[model samples]
Target: MTMANASNPFRGIRIGSASGAGLAGWQAETGRSPAVVHKHPVTYRCPLGHETTPVFADLAEEEIPEYWDCPRCGRAGSRRPGTQPGAVGPELYKSHLDYAKERRSPAEAEQVLAWALGQLRRSRGEEPAG
Candidate 1:
């Protein structure tokens, strides 16, 4: 044995290798042309006026949502309808009261609550509270 093999057990041995020489790997990976996936750009602007455009695969258009999170400010962004992302226009703004109105009218909620309380009282076999 040579002096070099004396220092290390694995020095003279290769544990494993590909079927062929190094060139085989290059041939297997880049031997032919590869196709690129298509992408579409979607733009959004947050209420704070931060704009960001993110690219999505063309296949994902159906799954893309109107709002996206801003990469910088972390706010949800809105997409402008009927125009490309660069266009600026009025955006609908909603307040807490607006959202609440959509959920329930004051009288409607009171009726639902009363009905729920009556059900609970009947379940317990107790007199319904006024």
Candidate 2:
């Protein structure tokens, strides 16, 4: 007697189960899904030797964290707490101020003063006179 042919096990198998099928079904039913995004907080240690500071989430790219100082190991970088997206810490304005103070030049001081005046004028919506 002749034996019957066996059927293919995966002949009509679909590519996705319930979870994976949602994307396609939802897209077909609706237009699209909302995009997901995240804002991550960062922490930075002082470049000098002092303390570690937590950077604020709303800070701009150029604003450094408060209380940031690393006198011993001298590491300067932001560390993310979890597996979130991260960005480079802000520039240390205090370090720049200290450097400018140590220079102690009249012309440099005058330049800084002028820059500050210009910034003040701009903030107040006034045109800075040249």
Clashing pairs in 1: none
Superposing all C-alpha atoms, what RMSD in Å does each candidate have to the true structure? 11.2, 17.8
lDDT of 2 by residue, 60-118 (tens): 66663433434455444334322222345434345666777888788879988999999
Cα lDDT tens digits for candidate 1, 36-128:
668888888886788898888885556987777666765567786333223343334566777877999999878988999999999999999
Q: What's model 1's lDDT at 101?
A: 78
* Candidate 2 segments whose C-alpha is farther than 4 A from its true place: 1-101
Each model's lDDT comes to: 0.67, 0.53
Ten residues in a row with the worst lDDT in model 2? 77-86
